[model samples]
Target chain A: MTLELSTLVAILAMAAATILTRVSGLFLIERVKLSGRARQALEAIPPAVLMAVVAPTALMTGMAETMACAVTALAALRLPLLAATAIGVVCVAVLRAIGL
Target chain B: MTEIIDETNTGQKPDAGGFMDGAKAILPLIAAVLPVGLVYGAVAAGKGLSVLEAALMSALVFAGGSQFVAMDIWTHPASWAGLGFAALLVNVRHVLLSASIGPKMTAFSTPKKYASMLFLADEIWAIAEMKAREARLTPAWFAGVVAPFYASWVLSSVVGAIGGALLGDPALVGLDFAFPAVFIVLIMNFWQGRRTGAVLLASAIAAIGVKSFTGGAWYIAAGALAGLAVAAFASQGEKTENGETVE
Candidate 1:
C-alpha cells in the first residue's frame, strides 16, 4: 500500500519524537546530576510510567478481555517472559474464540 | 543483588564470554519486545506504509510504544499539529526513563553514551541496572550489553514489518502477544519483594483511577502522575520514620 506524503511525514515525526523521549532522559540525567531525593523519585517513575501505559488498556478493554489478559500475564510472570507473553496471547485468542 | 554490584569489579574486559553473557541476559528481553515490534509492523503495514518506511522507522526511531502510538494517530483524521501533539504526550514518559538511567551512565564517552541511549527501553534499563549492580561493570561494559540488545530489537522490528506486509494473518503466527506478556513478566519481577509489591499495587490503582476519568492517551499521563504522587508520599513517610533520607 502506497502512503501519502503527509502520512509519511507524520510517521517520521512521530518516530523522531519517540526517540527523543527515550534519549532525552539519558541525556538530561547525565548532565543534570540529580540528588538523593530526586534519585528516589526517578526510581519510582517506571511503575508509574508502565501503569500509565498498561492500566488504560486493561481497564477499558472490558472485564473478560482484561481479566483474560491479566490472568495470562500473571501466569507468564511465573514462567519466562517470552513464554508468559505467549501464554497471555494464546489465552486471549482462545478465550475470544470460545466467545468468553 | 545489591552485594553483587558492590563486590564485582567495575572495569572488565569485553571478552567473548562477556558478550555471550550479555546476549543471554538480553534474550528474554528480546522475546518480550518482539511481539510489540510485530504489532507495530502489522499496524504500520495495515496503515499503507511501504516496507522501506517501516524499516527506516525501526532503524532510526526505535521507540516501540511511541511508534505504535504514532502509527495509530497517523490514521486519525486529526491535523498534523494534533498528531504531533499526541505523539509528544504519548512519549513524555521517556523523559522519566532517561532520568532514571542518566545518573548511572555518566562515565561514558560522548559517542558511546549516545549510541547506548538508543537501546534504553524498560527491559534493557532493568537488566542493565541489575547487571551493573551485580558485575560492578564500568560504563563501557554497560554499553556492550545494551548495544547488541538494541540492534536485535531494530532487526526484529524490520523483520516483523516486512512479514506483516507479506503475510495475510500475522496474528495467526502469534506475534500479537509480545507486549502484554512482556509487561506481565516485567511487572512480576517488580512484584517480588514487599516494597515493590506496595509500589505495584499503588501504581496499578493509580492507573485505574486515572483511566476512569480520562479517555484515550490521558490515562497514561494521569496514571504516571498519580503513581509519582503516591511514591513521593510513601518515600517522604519513610524518611520521617527513619530520620534519614533514602538514597
Candidate 2:
C-alpha cells in the first residue's frame, strides 16, 4: 500500500477542509450575520448529522440493531452517553451472540 | 456579533490548572474512545491504507466520526473529493463546537488559540463545557484534556493497525460494531431538548431515503440539510419555551 500522488493530494485537501471546519465556528459567528432561525439550524446540524450517519446503517444491519438503538435512545434519557452506548452495544452483541 | 463580543472574557486569569482539570475530566471518555481508535486503525489497514496514512489522519484530522466516514469511502487518491465533502459535512458540527468554546478561548493569544483548535473534539468540548459550569475554564485546561485524548486516539490507531496486520481481518470478531456504537454514544449527548427528536427523525428519513436512491455521500449531506431545514422552525419554539422540555 503506497500513497499515490492523487491520494496524497486528496489527503491534503481533506486536511485543509477539516482545518477550516475546525476553525469555522469561532470565525463564522463574527463575520456571518445569522438569524434566529439560522442559529437554530446551525445548532441542530450536529445532532441531525448524528442521526443521518447511524439511522440508515442501523436500519439495514438487522432487527437486533434497530432494537439496540432504541434501547440506547431510552438509556440516553436516564444514563450517561457512554453508559447508554454500552447498553446498545451490549444489546447488539447479545442478540448477535444468540444468532438473532 | 454583539453576543459573541459580549462573551469575550476580558481580564480573566490565564490559569494552568485547567490542563490538570481537563486531564482528569476526560478519563471516562478515554476508555470509550480507545477501542474506537483501535477499530479505525484496523479498518484503515483492512482498506489497504499504509500505516502513515492511517496515523496521519488520526493525528491531523483527529475527528473520530469524520475519520470513520472517510475511511468507509477510502480508495486512495480518487476518493478525496467525495471523502472531503462528506467528512467536512460530517465535521460541520465542529464549527458549532468551536463556537461554543470560542468565547472562553478569546482570552488566549492568537498563536495559542490556533494551537488549541488542533485538539477540538466532541468529548473535549463536552468536558470543557461541563467544567465551565462549575469553574473558570482556561485554554490551558482545554488543551490539557485534549492531549491525552489525542494520544489515546493516535496510539490506538497504530495499535489497531498492528492488530489488523496480524489478524488479517478487522471484523473477524465483530469489531465492526465500533462505528455505529461510537455514534450511538455521541448522539446520546445531543439527544436532549425538544427539537432534537424532530430534527433527528427528519435527518434519519432524509438519510435513509437518499441512501436507498443513491450510492454516494448524498444520504449524509441530504440528511443533514433536511434536519437543518426542519430545525429552522423547531429550534425557535424551543427557545421561546424558556425551559428544558423533553419529549
Q: Which structure among the candidates has the greatest lDDT?
A: 2
Candidate 1 lDDT tens digits, A1-100 = 4556766676667666766877788778667866556655566666666656666556666554587568766785467766777777777677656665
Single out the weakest 10-residue window by summed lDDT for candidate 1 chain B: B1-10
Q: Write the per-residue lDDT of candidate 2 for residues B6-105, one digit (tens) a residue.
A: 2245435444565677788899999888878888998988887777778888887888888888877777445778877877878888888877776666
Which regions of candidate 1 deviate over 4 angstroms?
A1-4, A30-38, B1-21, B76-87, B136-147, B165-177, B192-216, B239-247
lDDT of 2: 0.76
Give the per-residue lDDT digits (tens) of candidate 1, residues B172-228: 543554564555566666552454556656767776776677544665566666666
For candidate 1, what is the lDDT? 0.63
lDDT of each: 0.63, 0.76
User: Tens-digit lDDT track for model 2 on A1-100?
Assistant: 4656766666666777778887878777657788777777887878888889898768977887788777777777778756666677677778777776
DockQ of each: 0.52, 0.60
Judge candidate 1 at residue B67 and give its lDDT.
65
